[model samples]
Target: MSYVKDSDGRWHTIFDQTKGSSCGPTCMRMVVKMMQNRDLGEEQARQLVERKNGVAVLSTLTSENGGVGQMGSHNWGNHGHHASGGGGVGVGAEPLAAALKGTGIKDAHVPQIYARQALLKTSLKNPGIAAVGWGGQWNGKRAQGAHWIVVAGQLSNGNILVFDPIYGIGEIDLSPAIPKYRPANHEATLYNKNVVLTAK
Candidate 1:
């Protein structure tokens, strides 16, 4: 159910995320490959986060109560696909933009807010992939935190072809609402924050 067939009858590969906090790097890695025709491995993409953020890979967490927390820096929940967390940790809008720029994607940027669905479709048709900040769950649950996923392309039926690092590849119908961060009837949600790279 996660895979979809293309026009030429090829099924898209599902690049699932290995850690709860790795969605950012995972999506970025896919974007780089789609844009430049170069494959960046998981560790390499994590290192890219370190180089861009100017911080060592986050392997340990310091709690506010002066206690050392286990696993990654922040708690993004330990889901099935997300094993023990660490390495490259997490990324925000600004840090994600910086990381993309560091990868030679000079025009990479995170828009101030969500753009129109038409514009989003247009971006998907561009020369590269887009990283969407999602806040909903596959089960249609509303989440407080955001998740990163790649919008690979638009399906012929008007559904969005999404490469969710956490949930795998699937198509979803997005709402026409402006800030499409809220879930409607328990479906995939999207935040206003997005990291898009239209150029190599």
Candidate 2:
């Protein structure tokens, strides 16, 4: 469930599953389970899960189910058929949002796209605040879709706190690397380091 750097300079994590089930469902289940155990209210749970690492879990869930589907294909009945094509927000975001809402958080289902825009707009209203969306590219081509991230807060040391769903629980210095799915020519990638937030 966590990434570790091995002697081979590669990242690895221990994975567990029952009955060949995918980790996506299991991970979400764990999050929900943890929330219930703590008796966290909906909004509080939403904020907690919206932390840097929580978003990463959400992202993984979406990626595993195929990128979000396009338009009409997003309907549950049509998911499998159009999922392969990829365009709309995948099945993952809404459910996660809904779960957060169930905990009493309203509007938790903010789409990644909307989050990106809101981050930018909100930052513009505050000088010295900024936000950016950073992600690896397939070679020189932009990745098919946005991998949303938020950079917030300035520590006394001048370092920024990054909130990323794809990264883990803590603040990580950003870097770029090729994604697993791209063709070799597209191997050179930008890291998820773009500033999704900045001061106005």
Candidate 3:
């Protein structure tokens, strides 16, 4: 069965929380819940994303940004619990790092590509949550584009458990192999990943 922090935790989903773009923030919400049992509301999560270097507003829009490329992350450092401004402009490493800096996990490491898979696996295997960047769905394939999601844990079967905000697949099996993006298939897959945040 798919797992989520709790029924209340699901409310942190992007659609439930932001009228704008927020895959990255929504994923962070899951990270906060996985790392800590806190049920960060969408409003609170959104506020954390907008903190510091977050792109509170985007100049352009993309499908991944949910047509609202004008907002930020959610969850940790969410003492403010602010709501998203409402646009789908997704964030990159810089914004994510900035958001981390504002919280107790300021030193969060975003690994370089060469070591990404290993670090992600190690963190999840160590029973830690990993906030990851990917393509939209990540259905055991390579990433075709950019999106954000959470790596909740590793299943006993050795498959990766992915928490896709849009698909809402709880702990779905993601093979160890990294799938590449195929224009024809459009299979949402994982590409690069990192231990977005963790316990100090």
Give the TM-score comparing model 1 with the true structure, all chains together. Answer: 0.64
Winning model by TM-score: 1
Residues 1-200, model 3: lDDT tens digits = 13444222332322232433456667666655554556666665566666643344432222332322223332222211111222223445445555555544555555655323533443342222233323433344333234455554444645445555555544433443553322223443443443454433
Candidate 2 lDDT score at position 117? 39
State the lDDT of candidate 1 residue by residue for 2-68, as single tens digits: 4656543557654556655666677777777766767687667766764654443332221111211
* Model 1 lDDT, residue 161, Cα: 62
User: Which ranges in model 1 have alpha carbons more than 4 Å from their true place?
Assistant: 1-10, 54-89, 117-143, 175-186
TM-score of each: 0.64, 0.30, 0.56
RMSD of 2: 11.6
- The 10 consecutive residues of candidate 3 with the worst lDDT sum are 78-87
lDDT winner among the candidates? 1
Which pairs of residues collide in model 1?
Answer: 140-186
What ordering of candidates by lDDT runs from best to worst? 1, 3, 2
